[model samples]
Target chain A: MQNAEKKCAVKKCAMEKSSVTEKVFMSLTGLFLCLFLVVHLGGNLLLFKQDGGAAFNAYSHFMETSWIIRVIEIFLLLFFLTHIFMAIKLTIKNKQARPVSYAVNKASENSSWFSRNMEITGGVIFIFLCVHLYNFMFSQRFFHHYPSMYAAVRTVFQNPWYVLFYVICLSWVGFHLIHGVQSSFQSLGLRHPIFTPWIKKLGVLFAALIFLGFLSLPVYFFFSRTSRRNVQSAISHQLKIENGFKRGASQ
Target chain B: MKFTLKVWRQKNAQEQGSFVTYEVFGISEDMSFLEMLDVLNEDLTLKGEEPVAFAHDCREGICGTCGLFINGRAHGPLTGTTTCQLHIRHFKDGETITIEPWRAKAFPVIKDLVVDRSAFDRILQAGGFVSVNVGSAPEANGILVPKKNADEAFDTAACIGCGACVAACKNASAILFVSAKVSHLSLLPQGKPERRTRVLNMVKTMDEEGFGNCTNTGACEVECPKGITLASIARLRREYCKAKIKG
Candidate 1:
């Protein structure tokens, strides 16, 4: 009996460590992903330059070729995967914790709707991310569907359906971040009486900025006549140059 | 005043429960929520029906014994008040109040409007006490505790183990209760000796009791009758990290 009790104690300690550790890791990875969003939004701002895609294309080229970026990309992928995995795992346990549902839950009376429905918002963002990566990242690196990143953006956003989808997804991202940023800090135990309220407000402000910043790009490309004309002419000019080079090589 | 009450009824833990509507009349607006229930029970008993088996001890709010998930909010619509302290004036004359026991896997319903909250006692047994004995009472100024720590500890120690936080949480997480216990004890000198082991063991037992992990929704904080802040949870995390590192 003594030996069995000792083994049970060991098992309990390990289980306790992992459960809390899982949450700590979730916080760390979530904060890292938030940082990635800041950097990504900053880089994408280059698309707004009036130079007809030259600066944006150059930025994309450097991003594609840099070794440092490659390493960061690997970490980014890992963070995304781990955050998603932990979310699903935690959500399942949360559901089981309340086997019987409340007959009349006025949850909104106590907490914000976004705070309660993080899984729904997160799942929506994940679905958007899959489509988004396929549209830009995969197409540029693997498919070579467009000559330049800006060209791909121009073509894709021209379709009203894609623009609508992008706008809706960006809104979901805003909802996710509104709760996510401050919640991450709380999970990591970085809270203060005065600073916590400020952190929550700042989180909402940051989420709004991200939404508007990302929203401007697709909206600009879709509606601005100048950008539309410029992209069309730029694509044709690039095609002509490529054909000329092909004929010269044949001779 | 007359009102409709939809109360949950169950014979035993194994039996499934359902809402039983009871029309209660002549209920005064000044009566406490539990007193109103008592009136309903008095009527039920006179009619040779099984009286609603609700739990209560001290009519005062401090005991934390009287809990009911009334009208979707824990302990009724009022904030920072237990059911025993909640007067019926808050409700409309013809209001249909829905009262149910705290719902969680760890807190199984024993009967109508009562759950086995011994999970809380078991968690407390894990490490909620200081085992060391200092035999005699010391001088008043012996420990020299800081005012802020003492106040915060006192605030956290006010937790009544009501399990209202659990009922209010969407995930039915008991982290608020556990964290409150941890914060109060860890803040004092007597509790410092077993801090590391206490946090680990209590958290283990909490998880074993099948409570959900906190999702930082702030629901538990909002619904806690003691007004325990989320900072206690943050402190718990900080303490857990320190313990793990030191270990």
Candidate 2:
């Protein structure tokens, strides 16, 4: 089967090609988005306490108003888009490659389970982001204009079906974040012998904390009461003011 | 430690392959993985059975010839190590091990353990190198590169042309392998002369060779015996972009 398939002199030069730079791009984009997730989780946790919706809304509003954050957010969005697009392209290309592996294929047994599941996890999270934007961003930014942001917030999550949808999104986001955080380091060349163990543990700790914070919101909303005190408590607890604001903010 | 080996045996490239089971007694833990296989091969020869065919060279682990798929992982259970260098101590007595070869579309089995890695050579021919002038070699100090960039490029250069990345990948992508080669030359002055043509030609070659695209699943880096990063692939994208823009 040794047909004479020859490439050009320079083209066949194996001395120069390796994937270092592309790994860096993948790492930077993936890590930056993880930072975005942390900030997002911080705001999402506020949804758990009383006045949570209004509080979360105010936090969202604050993020929108900052020029620096606005710029960063745009970049963050771009990072998400680029990462997804690259992932799709790369995956497709790999799929079209050779079929049967060599008898002595090494390295396939030693990889981690999480790293292997990136495609499944990434796809899940991508779907979650789209649904999240539809429920919170699209409705609030584009739909019926209510004078109070709190009213819009309460109206969305108060519905049992919507609350359930948000819950599912939060869980999948958590799954994606766990694998994403560590894989980013692998891409960036951070897998040094001594630090690898510590870094992996650190990633797990961080992912768990962030996931719990984000997951609390939908859980809190499910058990909400319509009492005026409920609304007041939500707003006061979420905004972090002591009692007596008494503004009706029910779950 | 002695262990039970379940190795795939194929009569030829076109013939059907099957797992041939054997038990090796009193194996030394310190012996390299290949040494243990050697002992077993000796046993097979005396028994009048065909000795197992496995690929290995530079038992020091750098030539990229050893391609054992052990226990479902590439290069056995060790992280960042080739089979020839992997110690037998990683296995326990009576443990059953499964051995196979590099599996991919472009790589076909030539014998028992060896596959046609010439696809990589083919890919390289497609434009993996920089075409510099045939004049006298440049003086050692002619090109001054930042120490950091040099170090970084060297890290990518560590890839041993082993097809582990291809085997570990679910999609049989050679992105990590190709990226390592691409990034090494792209970073240095010696590689600059043909940078534009290099990217364009190599990418076209990669597509033509039937290697799959990178999905960023990151299995390649995890399974690499050299710990080659996926970042090299990112640099490939940038190079591709620059090439596209220039064209």
Candidate 3:
């Protein structure tokens, strides 16, 4: 006999269909954010130049003044929001799926600890993002004028607690990235024997590079008193230029 | 060999279960795992006590009915062996074996070690079939399948609905089981007609059955008796994406 047909409503079908859709959404947004992180790290490397912050301040200035950068910043914020939203949604769905737990869980033998705890790492990174945005992007208390991104960054890194926090957060970001990149590729159905191992290696390398870039900035500024003094002088010089521009405009 | 068994003992589905330790003595090393349990049951019955209840069909490993969580590894410590196929010699003498039923919200323990795996059957019923006209066996030469694809299909088709993957997974995910079914059929031409709807329906049923989402831990793959690969799950992912985008 032919199998009897079962009818489910279109709405129900759509609801069921969205888990795969959610995965696709998370994978794409997460990969795009990875690209954003690479670009961010590249820009952040300017913090290390010995030009007394001129290169970094100029780069920050261009980023603030360019219309394209401003538009991309908005899009970046949207991407972050969507990525976090999908993560939370999928996490809740997964938790609900397994209402009962095993009595003796020996899960570490089968999977990496980092892979199992993506939500925790993602949570830490989100908290760090909020503090980072407050210190550099949204709050004007740290630096009174535009193009003071260098001063704000240097000032924040000077505090020992902030440095420690930044290092810890970057470590978490590294953990999240190492699992996320490969996972997103698999979620997108980009699995292959030859390329899978290489992709995993590349993920680790990218994570290490980003980790080093973020970590070095804090470590370098925290210990190098001379560099801190130089950054102070550069900030004063930039403030002088801002005052001059204001005075010229008023005149 | 002598062993202390800490078996999860529950009277029924409603009763809360607890581990009860039993001392099993004079166990033979040559006995299969189930045979050892058979000896334990025989002793319990002779003592006028209720014997430990577990499921088993074929004494051989093919039936997939026998399963247990021995010492935190599915089907004991040996890789790619079912519970029935496991021999007592592998387990050290005088060791305390912590045996528990497959713990998941979907697979509720019925008595002792036996769980209601009907959830899996429900998932299979959702979309595990291909629509074909009722007829005698069709000639095998009507459709041409590459040797590699045929081999791969046969490999995936070895899954026996054992529920070991669910028991082994940290999240209790049935993705391996469902994906194995999907991969085995979708690899051949006969299964092409319903591939899209099949995956979609099967996945939806899997979710509805309260099986956990796959976290790609590879636990199920490591614990699978048939050595089902994670590649099938990847194929499931590919099929799912294709169905959602195109179908």
Candidate 4:
């Protein structure tokens, strides 16, 4: 039998692929998602306008109708899927590289807790996405006469459990973003002594903004609904006492 | 000072390893970490037991041959120092220091606290040199080199090929080591001719050697004996991207 030839040869050698291929993919897709978050936040913030759901409903309707937005949404979904896939692949590969674990791993000292637990934070965000899609996208796709986007959001946030869940998930998103934004730049070979510090600072600020912005929606809805209910009950109680006193006086 | 040590012992690559504890007495606080080990080995030799095998070429820090995972840190608790340069003074008396081999699939344990680092050599072989022909030495100022470039290249060239970076890395990635080589050569004019090919082949070899990918955690920079910065890895990425685009 003839001996097998080397798979890579001088004549048209298959390009040398590094394990960092997945890392690069994850970084780019992750940054794309970050941009998507900013656009998403801008749209979601319309729920706060008190103009009754008209503006938010109109915005949601426009987003649904525009072909360009539909295309962008598809790209957004693709980026999310790719980022998740690459993250899992790289994580598993990294684990296998060190089979026999360190006897006494002081790994936490070497890096930040968030940087080390990116996979856990990512997993939390993934679970949040599933619930979010089910609540919002499911209504948009399935219900022919769907409620206004504002009503749908308010209804979801009215549940204390759901609001709490959202707050928790948004916190994890902040954790993931804090490390991920700077990490993407590092992975992309854009590190510079002068600019890296600024980039890191900017990354932290950006993550904080996302956390606070998203958390505000659920928190605001929850508190506003509860306060309105409280005011209504107090007014009704006062009316009951007045009605009772008037009936007694007449008798 | 008296201290206890828990050193990892494996007869060969095929066997599983475990820690073996030993006690040493009357060691001076000023003795280097390796000297303490030598004292322990001497005692074991006198007792007719096989001496613990470890790697150390230059007792001073520069040779990069010596490496140990002391007390969970790569080159002991002291930052920016090699195992050979780490003094017993940094360690307290009666403390039990755990010494282990560089634990990575790419760096298999050869024998007690020693790992086969030939994977590094193979990576170097793949593309760690300039293509200049051997002949009479070129004139000192034949080629004008920018001072800033020369300084940066020198800083990058200081990487001693110690596997501490791999040991310290969460992923056991060799990106730092390969990046050092790539940055040092690509910055110089003599290495300009084959910079693209050099990065391609070296990275390819690094991947093939069963080393993991860098996650940019920056542990390698913190644990590096030579204080090699993460900038080299950044340059490696830039070089790789440029090469891929050119291709």
Best by lDDT: 1
Model 1 residue B57 CA deviation in Å? 0.7
Among residues 3 or more apart in sequence or in different chains, the pairs in candidate 1 whose N, CA or C atoms overlap within 3 Å are none
Runs with alpha carbons beyond 4 Å of true place in candidate 3:
A1-16, A140-147, A226-251
In candidate 4, what are the lDDT values of residues A97-177, reduced to their tens digit?
888877876776677888888999999999999999888877766673356777788888899999989999999999999
Q: Give each candidate's fraction of reference contacts reproduced.
A: 0.67, 0.38, 0.40, 0.61
lDDT of each: 0.91, 0.73, 0.85, 0.88
lDDT of 3 by residue, B1-247 (tens): 9999999899999998899999999999998989989989999999999999999999788988998988888888888999999999998999998888888778899999999999989988977888787789888698899999999999999999889899888668898999899999999988997787788888888887887767666789988999998889889889987776564
What are the DockQ scores of the candidates, in order? 0.50, 0.22, 0.38, 0.55
Share of native interface contacts present in candidate 2: 0.38
Mind giving the per-residue lDDT tens digits that candidate 3 earns over A63-142?
A: 87899998998999899999998888767877765565566666676678877888999999999999988878776434
Q: Write the per-residue lDDT of candidate 4 for residues B1-247, one digit (tens) a residue.
A: 9999998999999999899999999999989999999999999999999889999998888888999999998998878999999999998889988999899999999999899999999999998998776899989899888999999899989999999989999889999999999999999999997777788888888888888778888889999988788889889998988876665
Give every collision pair in model 3: none
Comparing only chain B with the true structure, the TM-scores of all models are: 0.98, 0.95, 0.98, 0.99
How is the predicted docking of candidate 2 categorized under the CAPRI scheme?
incorrect
User: Candidate 2: where are CA atoms >4 Å away?
Assistant: A1-114, A126-165, A178-216, A226-251, B130-155, B215-219
**lDDT tens string, model 2, B147-215?**
988998899889999898888877677878877887898898778876766776776666666766554
Kindly provide the TM-score of model 2 when superposed on the true structure, using C-alpha atoms. 0.67
Chain A only TM-scores, each candidate in turn? 0.84, 0.71, 0.82, 0.92
Model 1 docking tier (incorrect/acceptable/medium/high) = medium
Candidate 1 residue-wise lDDT, B102-186, digit = tens: 9999999999999999999999999999856578877878777889999999999999999999999998889999999999999
